[model samples]
Target: MAHDILISGIRRWARLPVAGRIAIVYLLARLITTGLLLLAAHASTPQSRFGLSPSMGQLVLGWDAQWYWWVAENGYPSQLPLTESGEVAENSWAFMPVYAFLAKGAGLGEWGAGALLVSLVAGFFGCLVLHRLLRDRIGSSAAMWAVTFFACGPLAALFQVGYAEALFVLLLLIALDLVLRRRYAPLYLVLPVMGFTRPGILAFALFLGLHGILRWMRRRAEPLPARHIVHIVALGAFATVIGFAWQAIAAVVTGNPSAYLSTELAWRRNWLTDPSAQFVPFEGFVRGAEFWMGQAGLPSWSGWLLLIVLVAGAAALLLRSPHVRRLGPEIRLWSASYLLYLLAVFFPQSSTLRLLLPLTPLWGALAVPRSRLYRWGMLGLCLLAQWIWILCMYGLAQTFWQVP
Candidate 1:
């Protein structure tokens, strides 16, 4: 029977390892998460979030969510001149084209419906890829924890309302997986998607491509196989060149290489130049610490609490073993890419919660350390921090989007 064959396929996966299990469960949990949302939707009033239902393509995602909806509903913008002038105002560089393309794919539903379609499939694939990378390099247990952590966090929360984070995280994990498997060709292909999604992703694609090249060059005397090296170099060249080209287009259109950085993300960039722009303003580092420790935006102590544990865990994971260091650069790169983004957002506040969500993979890895006491302690701290952040974010989202 087809049912028996399907059940047998599902049951035959124990050979994969803990990471494989986690990866399997991560995808399984997403289905369950979707089901939970659908059930809640049907149980509640049509407009009442707590009592609504999910039609096949309904959308309930939040924040700037409506913009994607507009694109999905209406289709791409055609450039048109103003009625009284010759000035041409195109769609501008503020919005990317992919979300609209997606909206249209979801029967022209925009971001909300399109997001659900994009993320559910993509994020599920992401879990499988993350698991494969871990299984091939590290143990399955480490992979499982990493995938599990991601599935439980704010990253997963995006499933309810369709957000960029879901798609972003999936592409990120896929690109990393390709590198881990030495499948440079597929990695290069995925990088462009990341670049289109966020300008910062060009940096990620370039760095990963470069690392793969240097790795091949270092293995020059091993006599492994010249054909594979040629393939890798070719792929790296494509990603690096093409990735930068797209970024250049964005810069030229915006009239400054960094215009997109500032024009679209004014609040984020203000902290870099303006002294008074910080969430907690103070003179000395110590004074800044004191100010930050008492701020309302970041919950005073939770920010510092996350900082201490994050750094300590990072050091431990780095020192774990030479094998881990050699085979699993994806783990390090995964954390590093976001660190680059967060360090750029040093002013006002770090947007610590958003910065922390994607690092769930790293946190899960850190939890696997030999220092059981320290690991559990840090884990507890992280869980508490995650809880506080979720409740706070839920309140903020509700206030902004749920207000009738």
Candidate 2:
């Protein structure tokens, strides 16, 4: 696996050179992140609380991580459909099947267990990937900072708890960096992995397609580059094929093209601004309008922050140096994916912050230019917002997805 290869490479490449400093710093950041995650799990444990105290064993092992476990153990159970709680216990409902597949084959615990295992594995590798990405664009010191901010930042709290985002970001960042390097085939390979990692990946296909079109248009007087067009078409086609393949198989087995959707929770994130969706949207409004308005605004402050960070990241990419400008395609692909997420997912909530996690390391590297005070302040703000978002979403999300 690339993870193993990266660890080996880091050891040799960083042992006798200036790169060693960044390597040490990056490893230290990973340690800090790991420590903080363990501490958070232990400190706020249900054990300290009353009857509802969390099963500390499950806390570290895998219980809150159960949904993914169920999916992997069961493997897209069509007959079961939605569980009594209106939760889908199938592969589709679990969102990403690759992790589940890996977990299942490895004899990991159920989906949650597998997710937890993968989360840890992914988080560690994620730091390494972040270090590599930033090292190329921002030099060693800033690269170390970028890696640190990601693993130790507030988001680390939730990310370490066996969630998909941690693993997902590792793939996204690595793949994006590959794209920036113009390693087209490798990027394409990562693109499919990303596509399966999360539904939001569809945007990447569109972004790549757009880039190819723009490039061709800019050079229309010259003959079209077959390789460029092929890459774009191939990327888009792969995304579509995998997508329909899943739905087609599920539909054949379940008698519903959208069997996974039907099997999932009743939450119906169907793009409708339901009164059920918002996070106290009614608190600030009048009678009828206020309730639905708040419902629509369930994401509240965090949503706006996501928009700002995304825009800021995009702007930063454009204004960067020529060497840095090489990053344009990667940035646009990530930006497009996030934008698709913002639009496709109705009633965005704090969890939406998960979607923004990959962008942190890159943005952290970019912060090297600003004053230290401002950079630290901005980091603080992002961390605070992430904290608030975790609190709000963790407690509230279960409302939509129930456990057996």
Candidate 3:
């Protein structure tokens, strides 16, 4: 009788409108994340960045949240700060203005509260959009399961934090949905906001280009229109311009041509053998591979081999995996382009997983399996991973490697 009652309740829930279902899922996920955060705060030591028994505000506003808050309080510097050795130090230029300014405009009295409000709201809407993005490609049940995975995934803490990721992802999903629907007009507005919200717009621009090529190749069967051709080209150009606009703004404001690049490289310096190394496309990962491998007492060549294997594996998954193919081509193209963008610019480090949050669309592939045991097992693993991440990043933040 109890089992029947529980199944009936779940069936009723499944009948709810998509928005209602997503809202419930998002709320429950936030509650779980909140509980985990409280546990982490309880376990925090004196050596942790927030110290023992830190408040929820402290946990939310810690790490990069402080940087966003700083940007909100004081706009980017006209003259950049320099280290004792005269290299460009970490400054506000590394953070974009959209999330900070939006939080400030919330008028919540405190920046952290406003930032949290924005993140929570954006994350909820992001889940709704994600469900819509996947519903047609996969079945509704599978899509909902994918949404659950994303909401409760290891990086779920992002939904409650002050970081721009939640906002950036919301905008990204809208932009991608627009692209998939072939509605390019709305993207003009979305692209600028997304570009300013975070550093992933270039990948979107690249995806547009790749998408155009794919469409062109399939024109015989799909009937590509001239108007679409124009929209694709124009939108790609506009996205590229917006992508580089931040760098140009930083350079003009700071009166230094390399202000943004120098500031970004400052963070990478800590991991580089040569602190003064100039920015080189596709070099960061190669260097990062060697650096991490050397730290592990492995041959540098092994790192290169591992990098190659990882790249090939990712390619095989996107191009050949039946599960990923079910998501269709646009998602695969976006994932490939974003990974390429990361390889070109980012150094592998503690923040790598956080940086990969934009790939949330791929969660659909993981949810494609229909076995209840498999689904529940994946959920258990995700929750366990979430606990470990919070423990290291917030609870015991005593080491340099514990950074989020």
Candidate with the greatest TM-score versus the true structure: 3
Q: Write the per-residue lDDT of candidate 1 for residues 121-217, one digit (tens) a residue.
A: 6666666666666655556665555555556544364544545556666677777666666666676567667666644464464455556555766
lDDT of 2 by residue, 1-404 (tens): 99999999868865655445545644564465455434434444343221133333444334235555555666665564454555443434535676656655554445445555677667767777776776665666566666656655667654445556676788877876665565567875776676666555655656666666666776666455678668767876776676556556667877765564444323333323333322232221122223334466754455456555755775666556453454344564456555554444433433444555656544544446546786577667655654544433332223332111
lDDT values, one for every candidate:
0.52, 0.54, 0.92
Question: Residue 80: error of model 3 in Å?
Answer: 1.1
State TM-scores per candidate. Answer: 0.64, 0.69, 0.98
- The alpha-carbon deviation from the true structure for residue 332 of candidate 1, after best TM-score superposition, in angstroms, is 2.3
Better structure of 2 and 3 per lDDT: 3
Task: Give the lDDT of residue 394 in candidate 2.
Answer: 36
In TM-score terms, candidate 3 sits at 0.98
* 1 against 2, candidate with superior TM-score: 2
- The top-ranked prediction according to lDDT is 3
Residue-level lDDT for 86 in candidate 3: 85
Sorted by lDDT, highest first, which candidate order results? 3, 2, 1
Candidate 1, superposed: residue stretches over 4 Å from native: 1-24, 27-59, 70-95, 107-110, 213-237, 241-247, 251-259, 269-327, 341-352, 356-364, 367-387, 398-404
Any residue pairs clashing in model 3, and if so which? none
